[model samples]
Target: MSRLAVSVCLAALVLAAGPAFAQTATPQTPNIGGFPDSPAIPAPTNATYPGVIRYEVDATDLDRHIVSVRQVIPVTGSRITLLYPKYIYGNHADTGPIQLIAGLTVMANGQSVDWRRDAVDPYAFHIDIPAGATELEVSFQWLTQSDNSNWRVVMTQRMLNLQWEKALLYPAGYVSTGITFAPSIRLPEGWQYGVSLETTSFENGLATFAPTDLYTLADSPMFAGLHYRRVEIDPEGDDVYINMVADEAANLAATDEQIGYYENLITQADRLFGSRHFDRYDFLLGLTNQMGGIGLEHHRSSENTHAPTFFTSWAASAGSRALLPHEYVHSWNGKFMRPADELTPNYNVPTENSLLWVYEGQTEYWGDVLSARTGLHTKAQALVLLADRAAFYQNQPGRRWRNLQDVNNHNLLGYRVPGQWTSWMRGTGDYYDEAALIWLDVDTLIREQSGDRRSLDDFARTFFSPEGTDGDWSPRGYTFDDVVAALNTVEPYDWSTFLRTRLDADGPDATAPLDGIERGGYRLTYVEEPNADEKAVSRNWGSDFRWSLGFSLAGPNNRIAAIQWDGPIYRAGIGAGWDLIAVGDRVASAEVLREAVTAAKGGSDPIRLILRNGQRIRTVELAYHDGLRYLRLERIEGTRDRIGDILTARRR
Candidate 1:
């Protein structure tokens, strides 16, 4: 037989035997159990460390963004484990960057010793001490972020924000409060700095601080710049200083009226809490566009950064004034009276966030209220901002699936990751704004139930500042039950059920809690013109047509920034990131788009849009007929204005 005929015969035989092959037994799969984990590093205990840690950081290498460290740690045992910080306090996750440490060397008696990283925990390093070796010298370089690829660059040509936890490691056996550090830093020439730490001495460019516990050292970050100014906002009381740094000298210019606002902020906070937590406080304000932005909270200080022209352009920057108030409120809410789970022994332990809705949410509510009370934002602006928030939660689609309680875990799942479908996914920080709305509900309910004689302010004073601890800043832990007890003490009601109904409700039937708006004597209504706060925000964030066309435009080139889920444009198969090419017959501009939407209202015509999605070009006809809808708060007749009274400044 020929070779071709032989091949055809083989194929025919295989096809004829296919059924028999299919009837063969299935192959058995291998199964294996996981290998046992290495023994855990020593758990932290309350015993005090025998000796202090001598730590030094040389951040003078600004051009390369390298932070060099040399730490001398005293040792008593033969085997010791060192742990890199994993759970940053404000971040609410195990997000410390262990990958940034390079050129690590451990030395004993001037001889390099071998070290091994724990297989299960990469943040831990194990080393054996040689006989008669009293201390171990460790050196490493922290490669600070130099570009904008992932994180914000902390080091710039003219300024730097030094977070101490990023530079040093701690022994594993003792709690963070038991380990002490005499920390020092060397900065660039002619640069002044601001920190919450008490400076013991300064020589040349190096500054040395008093010996402090590991927990406090990490919390006291430094903001240094060539142009710096310090002003005492509360000189009559526990010294509260606004330590400001800027890239340019002119950016530090604060008019007398602008300075008055900050002074009013201190007074307003004092009256609201009716107690002091810290002996001294510092507002570390960075007025620079170059440094990595931060708004983190600490017990006695806060890290805040704004536009370089924050003082120079006060009126134009009104929308951003609430940042200081928000972070400052954390002193009473989060830093002092903290959640029990968040009061971890050390930085490596993970934290639970069941009460973040109260920690971050109520602070957000009080932040805006304090902003209004201190004249950071006008009373009219405050109402408009409230209206905007009301409309947002009312239109949000994520509530159909995720409730407020479950959303607290989002910090660990995906913190700060942007989403194309953000409205449905509900990003991590929604607790800030959404919880604010819930607290508003609580505030209004309290006032109504008490016949206007009591409010959330009473709850804050009684709960945050208990009896006989007037000037204490010690950490006081609380549980969910404690929160309920405090609320009931302020106003007698089923506080637990009230909070759970709003926190645990989900599915297709769930809706926003807007009873607060109604009870506060305002009703959320749509208008043809944008409110003042919205217009000011739109100047930089682009136009918002969320209610009219169910989409908004932002960023460069008028691209679709956000599209409402299952709304007009979404139902029409148009999505975000589509660049607007034209609106009807005119070039695509905010004005042109508004005109097109208005023209289509009450008419048979569809809103025509020419959009370029990637390389594909297509024309979409939106069936939306609503014309330029914007949200505003209207006063309800014959009802008390509870919201106004809530925001009104309290007399000392």
Candidate 2:
């Protein structure tokens, strides 16, 4: 439905239900838009009154970027507190998916109900029920996002992803798990959908799902499209399914060899962990040029999206091939074993997320490792990735002021800050990439300390799969002390100091990379031409030599991204926001910058740069010279081939 049509529907409801004056007016300003204080009530209530919710989604308006949602919530009291959940799981902020919802109204007993927003808990809306009302029907319009411009996407005539939490409301004061839901969706006439939710029946373009709890209901998202293909990636019938939907039929055709890599992935993961958490799993993928890309993890499935040509142009998309593998590993690391502070019973309550270094960072470490083990990317590609990450952080000027721990704490806001002068102007979170390097050090330290009898793989199976639970895929929360205690079980060390020192280090300290790389029997070096990994990354997004030069070159005119704090360029007083007019006395183009660096040949002679920063034109010379260098992994050849041991795939 078009925006006009949505408005028409909303206006019709207003006219039919009651006059505009009937709405219960909100008298006060909202304070921070969520429950301000911790709840005085205890969790789960010990008494399980099964709360139920149902949604009828109309996707006929997908072309107009609209989803008509009619929701019904059963209430058991004269006064009910209805909450549009904030602080949703997965996203570590109290501001959840509330922004995506529009055109909302609650009605009961054929009368327009009056609702008031709670001043303290802004996400909570207080609605008064009629004397004999059994249920309240809430209707709204959801705009499918096309971009961040209006925060909407009309993916394609073919594909759509449904995030249920953004559409429904529930009774307040109860755990999300304590409530039950029966979700029914109506898609486009010929469109098919994939979800972990079991099917009850499908008729007249409507598909109703088997009843489940709120936690499980929200955990299972749906991917639907006109073009669909389902492949059983594992012979073990209930193990895994790869459901791929695309914009076109040709984009959906994947070769057997290409699919075999993922099959091998399932086998390798099972052997490494020695257990399964969920009864079944799904990899829900959406391939479309019409929609913005996505990668969100759930306990039983992952919502993955990429370019329409993610498979056809494998070499070009090789950089993102590990996206599937990364989210898959989360089923073990994040979904199974979360940080204790982050494991809240409901989304409305604020969650403490200081331990993302272990939760997301260690998961990042295993993600890179598993990508190599599963043949999603070659072992050489893995080395290049780590080197790229280390080199990337080494050039990040923000590390001087902030530490890795702070990055985790401020991730929600830090992620969107642009890279115009990233190294200097802002301190972005480095938990994922930088934390991968940190966890790699932890792995190497374990290997070196234990004389190869144990590795991080043991840490994985031990920490992720706790004994006695016997494959139950429930949230097993842990604290920092639990992490340190687990590390002690692997190999005793002063882990507290070891981690704190690394986290507190200021700016471009190369010790962790140098020590970790050497310990793994390899060293970081550079080459003239870009490697396969570098070429792929640079092709997608521009590349630079920030590791050595302290600033990245981007844009069509080769503009400065940021100056590394006291880096080769920063020392020369050339900074970010400066546009390069010429390099080597030639007009600066994409290739001109590279030719200038390559011509210098590590010579002391300064490479001249003509920079224009808002009408101030100046000629500057970069004093230090290192020819165009790309990061590569080189074997130390003598000590021990621990790098090889780490990359080897596990066998049954």
Candidate 3:
């Protein structure tokens, strides 16, 4: 037999030895590669504890209907503890006490031990260990119903709950936390497995990997499936793993071409940053059945989902590529150098760290700039994106309802009161939009002041210097004042007031500073309607509009039980207990109804509705608006100098 085949055969024998030894065996040393001179993995100085010891989870697909997960977390030392968050961060609402972890089973040194749930908070769980316990093992099952939107094992349908399959096992503080994950799936015999972790070992149908440390582990997200292609672009110089997971029926040749595009984008980003931080950084691409896109950032990896055809269309591909850059940049902005308190304490608690504008907004700005800089997007395309964001915020009715500080303080208070209003209210719009503009302003300021010798990159490197002592950067969380202070370091002129007036408050002169862009040989104009060629390439879902009456009606098996008055239905002569069988010759399907509504065209046409009251069938036409509302654009002739000069200014 070949030497490589022999090695694989021996490894298989070791894995087949069973769980008792696997559970007790000491962890193997990490094989650090790539940079020989890189510093050793930093250890926790203040605390003498093992950081994220070991994690094992098994989630079985029960009858192809429901999946249940049983996890065992082993920690170092005689005392073992684990935390189950009452609510995951970014979710903002309590998961409600249903005991997701039911009937705790604890074993210490092959003997069962009694344990109690000590403390419960929105973010963590605390478990105790008895005396003389050398090793600890915790086993609990989480029931996942097939139709349960509240809990999900793989990808969640809700956008806000994207990272639902997350668990944090902290052997220490930020210094260490272990995560355990298992996708609910049934694998075919001899199927190959691909993951993003630095280590890959499979035993008893479970894959395991101990990341570099807590930080790197938290940053690496895992995706498991049979249909995927693993491409390693620069394995020797910079370790980049791309796990492109798609539907089995997808076009493999086209997928390869798209992967090449992504590989180039990531390589360029690394070049811009000047350093590769992680030993193994990965991108987990989950292909969905329909049209939608989302990207979540982990410490060393990112979870990205999009349709396969996204690469076929110029507009769609450009937008998806733009999203990739923003999420990848988070490895620095949102991961390594985070708001210290926000990292440890609850994120919902309000703070004055207006720097999210810098984090989220500056990142948003860079997404476009980097795309254009790398020749992935044209200058005109980038400008259109910026204009779209700006116009969306400018047209909102709630732009004057709140300030940026107030929005930051109440960002987590749910969408209706603080959340949704904060997102949609344009008083300044989300920081992403305003921050992009602010970055442009700062870039202009730096260029003008330093004769184009310094730009926002200087500010970024100075503030987010990985080599600097943590305290030298923002420690107690950065405020508006801190940002202004950082800006003054480069400009050295009292430019703080300029930022506050333009960004924090609405002023007539807020956009005046950008006028110099025209003088610098660029033109700016907002376009609403697409030209003939543009419309030809765009996807249209046809024009058929429908409106919901203000009332909510519910029934079992399509039979009406109660009617909610004050709903659009009640005003439209539809009463409670009226059975709704059709909405214009089509039976209603919850799935298809929403799709039909969003794709409907806007016009003053009445919707045809059929309802059954007792044995009588009543038909009515509901009045609805069906017109397309869009932001228009046009390029100005011979106005490049006027607009370019404004765009090149230091401050508005």
lDDT of each: 0.86, 0.76, 0.48
- Model 2, 1-652: lDDT tens digits are 3334545565565556655645753333323333333222233343454456787878778657788888788876777776777776776766555667778798898889987766445566777798899899999887667675744364567888887887777777778878888889988888888899999999888999988888898889999988999988985565699999998989987888889888988888887777878988999998887766778788899999889898888787777777888788888877888888888888787787788877777877877777788888787777777777766665566766666777676746633445555555443346667777788888888999999999888888888888865469988898888888888998999988888887777654523334777899988787778765667655632347666566777777677775667787788887667888888768986577777777777677888888899979988888757676666778887878787778788876
TM-score of each: 0.93, 0.88, 0.65
Q: Please give the lDDT score at residue 240 for candidate 3.
A: 71
Sort all candidates by lDDT, best to worst: 1, 2, 3
Best by TM-score: 1
Per-model RMSD to reference: 7.7, 8.1, 15.9
Q: How far in Å is the alpha carbon of 200 misplaced in model 1?
A: 0.5
Candidate 1 lDDT over residue span 271-384, tens digit each: 999888888888999998888788999998999999999999877787789999999999999999988889999998888888888889999999999999999988888887
Cα distance off (Å), candidate 2, residue 391:
1.0
Better of 1 and 2 by TM-score: 1
lDDT of 3 by residue, 435-500 (tens): 676677677666666766666666665555445443231223444566678777766767677666
Candidate 2 — which pairs collide? 1-61, 87-94, 144-153, 145-152, 145-153, 146-152, 146-153
Deviation of model 3 at 40, angstroms: 35
lDDT for residue 118 in candidate 1, whole number 0-100:
77
